[model samples]
Target: MEILSNLALGFSIALSPYTLMLAVLGCFIGTIVGALPGLGPSNGVAILIPITFTMGLDATAALVLLTAVYYGAMYGGRISSILLNIPGDEPALMTTLDGYPMAKNGRPGQALVISGFASFWGALFATVMLALVAPALSRVAYQFGPAEYFALYLLAFSTLGGIASNNQAKAAFASCVGLGISVIGLDNFSGLPRMTGGNLHLMDGVDFLVAIVGLFAVSEVFFFIEKHGKGGAVGVKLNKFRVPWGEIWSTRWTQLRCGVVGFIAGVLPGAGASLGSFLTYMMEKNIAGPEGKFGTGVPKGVAAPEAGNNSAAGGALVPMLTLGVPGSGTTAVLLAVLMTLNITPGPTLFTDRPEVVWGLIASLLIANFVLLAMNVPLVRIFVKVLSVPPALLLPGVTMVSFVGIYSLTGGYFDLLLMILFGIMGYVFRKMDIPTVPVILGILLGSNMEDALRRAMVLSDGEWTYLFSSPIAIGLWIFAVAGFIAPVYFRNKIRKPQAVTD
Candidate 1:
């Protein structure tokens, strides 16, 4: 009842003309970015973040727009995966397994409709879960101690490394690198500079959004170069896109089951939507036995993983919102955004700022419906978006990045710094190193340092106190496992196609 009342209040706020406009706009832009290969939700959010700041909109409104974009991108990513056999992100990789096949069979529009519907279902379920459970979950985070936090961070990195990337060493190294970079600016506790190298820009530390743009967006330019002259795929005519309503409703059970699977998969550390989808597919295959064609354009296979991944996308939000931890690369970006807004999203968020919480929840509900409508009737427009020349599109995107960053601080140094980071991003891609860890490092670094310092303060400098709590111990174990597990799975898990250029 309280949840309902709170949600009603949230709807009141979310539906206000201003917030509503932002939500619609966010969904529209988010879908475009999501549909583009190499520019996943994180990059999309990062690029637009500066623009929102420049607008000087209310914090909540900005968040509403950005988050809408996040979900929208999630909604749009399936387009490329289905039509081109190239996933917009790793999570969408599983979608391609069946989605591309479906497109190849002349059902690109159908495959898109199925995936869009699944995204809606998953997102709807997640919104409900968040509304009902976030406050309670936040209370759990409040009880955490430094030891527990350290463990939590450890678990986050290790689990992420173990699961997100194929090479555990590379992942762990990435984790280490991220943590180290987080320590770069001034030492909060000691009030001394450690790694700034006397550059004033170094004192402010790295801007996470800048880092994200470089890694995901700029790196994508390199990837685009790899396949420069390749034309779009055939067999994906977009004339008909009405949902096969009877077919979808008939598979309600599959939708429900996949939603649950995706949610659970998202909650677990190191697991993401890709894993959720893959697992769901295997489950469906087993359940149907030999009778089901399973992978050969079967509705269930597409429905299950699509629902699972989208649900996982929503589920990943739980830890980020309730626990201040991100379960995937994209949510890690969201975490950074929350910090920029000065609204830490965790247990305290529910009690201290219900408006942001409830408003976000309400907006998500609306966005899902919007996605269903857009994806079905307006998909042709989105496909047309793909045909826009990259040369023209890239310049506009670049200008947006520059203008957005300038609006944030109005500092020439910041713009220059962004350029430098962009170059660094380009270099990182050439090395085949994942750029997400660096951004993660920048986002988590300061907070982790503060947590460590506070823990020491409470413990009176007793180092052993870091492991005093069971939760803390558990987190450490998880982190270490995250670091090691990737190595264990490297040989077993097949590597996806390497990013090009």
Candidate 2:
């Protein structure tokens, strides 16, 4: 009954003409951004945040618009993945494995339609799950203390090595790099600069948006240049869009299973949509056995990851809204935006800012419907993004990224910092190092440090206090198990295949 009443209130606000229009506008803009390689949801939201302030919109409306863009970008990412063999964003990487092949096999239209439907179902299901789960979770989160929170952060960090990268050492190193970057601004406890090097800009530490745009967007430019303009053509000619009813029916179970998997993974801090999509694809391939045809135009292959990633996007919001811990890069930006608006997110947010919380939830549902309606009919148009020449596309993307960062900081120094990070990002990518852990580390490092210090202060510097609570102990145990479980399972699975061979 409480949920029902809140939904009523939420719908009333979300359905307002002004809020509805913002949602539509956000969705449209997000699709364009997502269709363009490298300009992901994070860049799209971060760029628009300053514009939102200038528009003088209320907090609820601003959040609604930004979050709609987040959802729309998730929906649109599959377009390039399917048609051009290029992932529009990191999470869409898994889709390219099967989606591109499907297109190459003369079924680009079917692939697009199927992926769109899969995305719709994933987003819709996850929105319902969010509505059901978040309120209760927020209440439970209210019970967490510094020790428990620190342990939870440990769990998030520990799991990343196993899920995000095959090379655990590289992931660990990337995380350390992020943590190191986070410590640059100041020693919050001592009120003294730690790594400022006498620069005022460094006193504030590295901006997350600057790091994101540089790593994902600018690094992409470097990568394109390295490719020397090769691989730019989309050989597959898309036919008129048609509903792939047969394909959808066939992959129904895969979509549902992956949707649930994606949502659960997204709820875990630092797991994000990339991990969710990868895990779902692997699971579907393994389960289908010989019949899966995973690499060569399997509808289920395309559907699973698309569904998983989109659902994970919804799942990522749960921790951000309920606990003030963002599960992904995009959610981290949303958290920053909320803080900028003077709306603190956490358990108290639910009670104190019911309108913002519920209205955003309602807007998510509306955005999913809008994406579904728009994506199917307009897929051909979206796919046309593939025809854009690399010379024009790369420079345009670079311009947008620079403009967005400049608008946000209004500083030439920040641009130089972004260029520096872009070089670092390109180097990291060329070396096969994963970037997500670094981003996650930067996002969570400060909060983790604060929790640890607070816990120590309470215990008079006794480290054992960090594990005194049952929740803390349990989380610590889970962290250890998460680190170990993947290796154990991999070896366990490989032995059987070895025996068969």
Candidate 3:
């Protein structure tokens, strides 16, 4: 009854002409950005954060547009991966392994069509899951103590290694660096500044947007410049967009299994589309037998990863919306945007911000259909986007990053920080040290500190309370496992592969 009422209200808000138009525009721009290599949803949305602020649009409208761009970009990202054998971002990497082979075999159009549809289905399934699960999850989060919340954040950061690179040490190092950077601002607990450098400007610490932009966008630009200098991109000619329903049906069980797997993975804190896709790919490969050729352009091969990634992207929203803890980088940006809007997300969000929450849910239903219509008929146009000269696009993206960071703080210092982090990001990218964990540390460190202090206060200086609650004990167990599981499993796999080779 409550959800129905919220949906009705959300429909009223989302159906407004202004919001609808903004949604359409955001979706179109996001698709274009996603279709272009090196410009995934994170960069696409970050570049536009300034634009959203400058326009002074309604927070709901701004969010609706931006998130639409996010999902739209995800849908479009499969295009280049399939046609050009190039993933637009790290998450799309799984898409290329089989998608490109299909394209190379003169089925570029078919591959794009299937991948796009798979993305749409995965997103739709996840959206429905969110609508059903978020309210319940929000209710559960209300029971959390600071200790539990802190443990949860620690668990989230630990999961980053699983989501990103298999290197636990590198991931931990990245997370530590982020925590150090996050502590640069005034200490909220001590009431005295720690790393302000005696500068009044540093009193507020670094803006999250500035850090995010520098880390993801500017860093990406520098890296791309080194690889694609003053040249055009490689192109592909898309032929026909056909579904081949029989082939799709043949993989129906695989698609459904992967879709469920993807959704479950998405619901986990810190797990995102990358983990979802990788897991789905591995699972399907193992499940395939003599009847299936595995990765050499089988339809199930494409469908599994596609479904998993799209579903995971949607599932990641569960924690972000219900508990205000992000499962991935892109969702972290969404949390930042929600904060900027002064709309708090947590157990009360569903009741307090029903329009924002349910409107987003309803809009997602519409957006999935919109993506299908757009990706199917416009497959050729998206393919041509690859032909866009890198010389032209790179400068525009870099300029956007510069302007966006500048607008956030209106300070040259922030600009300098952007450049510094941009270089740092470039170096991290080169070294293969996962950047996401750094973001995790920066975002979670303060919260962790807050929880620790609160838990200490409640225990009257006794530290044993940290392990008292069943929930806390459970979380600690999981956090320890998250740290150990990757190293153990990664080495286990590597040894066998090394022996086989």
Candidate 4:
């Protein structure tokens, strides 16, 4: 009954004229961003976050807009895969296997319509699950103290290396680099600067927004320019876009099963949409056996992965809203946003800022319907967005990154640091080091350190206290297993026509 009232409160905020308009605008922009190759939900949110800060939006409005963008990008990722045989982002890779084949059969519009329907059902299912699960999880987190929190942070990093990166060694290196960056400011315990090099801007450490823009948005700009504006090729133009209501009806079971698989995957702390899509595709393929014709562009093949990835995207929000641990790279960016707004995520968040949490939830529900309505009939407009040259699009994105970060901070040193981080990001990309863990480290490092310090103070400097609680012990075990489990599965997980990030 209380949850019902809370949801009603949420709907009231989400239905407001200002919030509804932002949701529509965010969905439109997010679809365009997702149609562009390489800028997935993570980059979409990061690029726009600084702008929200600059605009000085209230926390609820900012969250509503950005979350709309996140959900919209998940829907938009399929546009390129169905029509162009090019995945707009990593999770959309599986869509190409069956989607492109369907497109080649002169049914480009059918492939798209099917995928859109799958995306809607899958996301809707996960959103329902998230609503049911996050409050319970937050209640459990109320028992956590310093030892448990430090261990939770450790689990977050270890899981990222194990599940997010193909190479754990490189991910560890990136984690260390990010932690190093986090410690550059004044140390509260010592009351002295640690690694500031006597520079004034270093006093507050690296701003999360600046680092995010540099690593994601600016570096992407450099990559686009270097590749000579060849982000996507529309190999199969749509001759006609017809709604496939029968196809949608046929794959209802496939969507339900994939939604379940993807939502569970998303709720897990490091297994993201990539794994969800792959697992669901394989699950459907196995269920169909020899006659399913999954690889040759069957409708179920198009449905399975689309449902899985989009549902997983929604599922990834559960942990971020509950325990402050991001379940995916994009959720990590959203975590940065919440922190920047001075809204610490944990058990109290629901009680302390129910409006923000409930409003964002309501907005996601609204955005899902908005995306379905817009995508079903108007997908042709998003497909045309692919024709816009990366050369023209990237510079404007870069300018936003520069201008947004500067306006928010007003620090010349931050601009220079951003450029340096951009260069560093390019180098990291060249080296095949995943940048997500680095961002996670910066977001969680200080809090982890504080937890450790508090634990030590309570335990009188005893190391054993770090593992004193059952939650702490479980987190340690989970962290270790999370890192090792990926190694065993890394060889078996296939990436058919996988696009490099």
Candidate 5:
């Protein structure tokens, strides 16, 4: 009953004209961003976050708009997957397996519409699960001590390397780089700077907003120029543009099951949408046995991954809202937004600002519905986004980053720092180093330091205190397992992927 009333309050705030407008606008823009191949959700969010700061939106407004974009981008990824055989993001990679084939089979409309509905069902399922699970999780988090908190953060960092990584060593190096960047500013425990190099801008540490934009957005621009600046994609024209009610109804159970699987994957510390989608696609294929023809443009093939990834996207919000840990790279960018707003996310977030938490949940519900409506009837519009050439798109995105960052901080040095990070990001990408860990390391470094300090203070500088608590010990076990287990599981993830799909 309390949850019900809280939801009512959320609806009241989300129903406001201003917040609703932001949701609609965000969905529209997010779909376009996701339709662009290679930009992905993390880059999409990072690119637009500076715009929110430029707009000077309050916490509620910023969250609603950005989260709306998040969902919209997830939905829109299918556009490229079906039409261009390109995934808008890592999470959408599985969608290409069956999505492109269905398009080639001359049922692009059915594939697009089916994937849209699958996305809707998956996201809706995860949102409901999130509402039931997050509050309980947040309450449990209140009992964590410094040792437990440190262990949890360690678990987050340890698992990041396994996400779509070819080399764990490269990921570790990126994490070290991120932690190194995090320590550049003045140390709070002592009133002295650590690695500021006598620059006033370095006094506050590297601004995460600058880091995110440079790493995710600007770096992509650099990679595009190096790889495919002159290239363009040819989209499969949509024929028989109508809803596939029969197909959608037949795949209802698949959508429901994939949602469950994806939500679980999203809730894990480092297992993200890519994992969710991969697991669900494999699960569905196995259950259907050899007769299912998974790689051959089946409606079930399209539905399974679309639902799983979108569900994972919603589920990824769970840890971020309750534990101040990001379940995915995109959520890490969202975490940066909350940090910049001076709103700390964790157990107290629910009690300290119930309005923001519930408002975001409510607005997300509306955004899911808004996405379904836009995606179905407006499929034609999003398909057109594929025609946007790299030449114009890359420059436009780069300009947004520069203008938005400057408008928010008004610092020339920050711009230089952003370019430097961009260069670093390009190098990292070329070397096959995962960038997500680098972002997470920087994001969680300060918190991890504070937690470790508190633990040391409480235990009189005894290092054993870190493993004294059962919760802390459990986290340490998981962190170790997460880091090493991925190497064993790498073949399992790769073997199931169908080459043609």
Candidate 6:
């Protein structure tokens, strides 16, 4: 009954003309950002944060708008993945595996429609789960100590390396690189620079936004030039937009299963949508038996990852809202926005600022519907984005990235940093070393370090304190098991197939 009342209050605020309009506008902008390669939800929200301040809206409305953009961007990323074989963002990478193949087979319209529906189901299911489960989960999270938090972070790193890539060594190396970057600034405990190279800007550590833009947007430009030459571009044909209702219906079980898996993954810190999508795709491949032509553009291929990523997006918000801990890069930005507004997230956020919490929840539900409605009829228009020449598109993307990063820091140094990372990203791509783990490492490194430091302080440097709590021990056990489970299961599954062959 209380939940109903809270939801009613949320709807009342979310349905207001101003808030509703912002939601629609956010969805529109997010789709465009997501469709464009390199500029993702993090960039979209980070770039727009200043504009939100200038609009003079209250905290609730500003958050509603930004959160909508986040959700919209997730929906938009599939556009390029399916149409052009370019992932709009890291999370959409898996989509390219089957999405491009499906489009190439001349089911472009069906592919788009199927992904749209899958994204819708994923977002809707996760949002509903957020509404129902967050309160209870928040209560559990409230009991966490520094040790528990550190253990949880370890779990994230352990599971992430295996799940993010087939090459655990590369992932671990990338994660270590990210951790090294995270420690570049002044140490909080000792008040000394760790790896600043004595530069002034290095004293503040690397800006997350700067790194993200360089690694994704700027690196993409380099790859685009290399792959397509100066003037070449991939051309896509658009058939009449049609919903494959029958095909989508047949994959309902896959969608549901993947959605659940994605939501659970999202709820774990640092797991993010990319991991969720990858895990679900692998799961579906295993379950679909011999007939699942996953790599050849199967409908379920598109559906599973799309659902998982969107659901993971929704799940990422849970920890951010309830525990004041962001599960992904984008949510980290959202957390900063919340802090800037003087609205601290965590358990008290529910009681103290019911309006903001519930209103944001309500807006998410509305935004999902908005994205679905907009995507279906307007997909043909989105597909047209693929027709733009690389020479033109690449330059435009570079300009947008520069403007967005400059707007945040107002420094040329950051611009140079962007280019440097861009080159590094390009090199990493060429070497087949995954860059997502690098980003994840940077994102989670500081938090893990802080948690570990705090735990040691509490225990007078006793290492056993890290596993003092049942929760902490359980998390450590899971971390070790998760790291080994994938390799074990892969071998088990493949061995039987080899025998049959």
Instruction: Assess candidate 1 and give its lDDT.
Output: 0.76
Q: Arrange candidates by lDDT, highest first: which order?
A: 5, 4, 2, 6, 3, 1
TM-score against truth, every candidate? 0.93, 0.91, 0.94, 0.97, 0.97, 0.84
Q: For each candidate, how many residue pairs have backbone atoms clashing (under 3 Å)?
A: 10, 0, 0, 0, 0, 0
List the candidate 1 regions with Cα displacement exceeding 4 Å.
Answer: 229-231, 427-432, 493-501
Top candidate, metric lDDT: 5
Model 5 scores a TM of 0.97
**Residue 102 in model 2: shift from native, Å?**
3.1
With a 3 Å backbone cut-off (N, CA, C), the pairs that clash in candidate 4 are none
Question: Per-residue CA lDDT of candidate 1, range 40-113, in tens?
Answer: 78778888887777777777798789889988887888888888787766667777877888887878888888
Query: What would the per-residue lDDT of candidate 4 be over residues 164-210, giving only the tens digit for each residue?
Result: 77788988898888888888898968878989998887898998778
Per-residue alpha-carbon lDDT of model 6 for 125-190, expressed as tens digits?
999999998888778877888899888767766666655445567767877888889899989889
Cα error, candidate 1, residue 20 (Å): 1.1
lDDT, candidate 4, equals 0.86
**Residue 422 in candidate 3, Cα distance off native in Å:** 0.4
What lDDT does model 6 reach?
A: 0.81
- Candidate 4, residue 201: how far the Cα is off, in Å: 1.5
Model 2 stretches astray by more than 4 angstroms? 49-57, 487-501
Tens digits of per-residue lDDT, candidate 5, 1-501, equal 879988998999999999999999999988888888867788889988988987889999999999999999989988998998888777788888899999998999999999999999999999889888999999999989999999999888787775546677887887788888888888868879989889888899998989998988898899888886644456688886667899999998999999999999889876778778888999999988889999999999999998998898899999999999999888999999999999999999999999999999999999999999999988888888888788888899899999988988897988998998899888887777878888888898888888999999999999999999788899999998888888997876673221101
Q: Give the residue spans of candidate 6 off by over 4 A.
A: 37-62, 85-107, 190-194, 229-236, 241-247, 278-302, 323-353, 487-501
Instruction: Note the Cα lDDT for every prediction shown.
Output: 0.76, 0.82, 0.79, 0.86, 0.87, 0.81
Candidate 2: Cα lDDT at 95: 90
Q: Model 6 residue 85 lDDT?
A: 83
RMSD of each: 2.5, 4.1, 3.3, 1.6, 2.2, 4.8
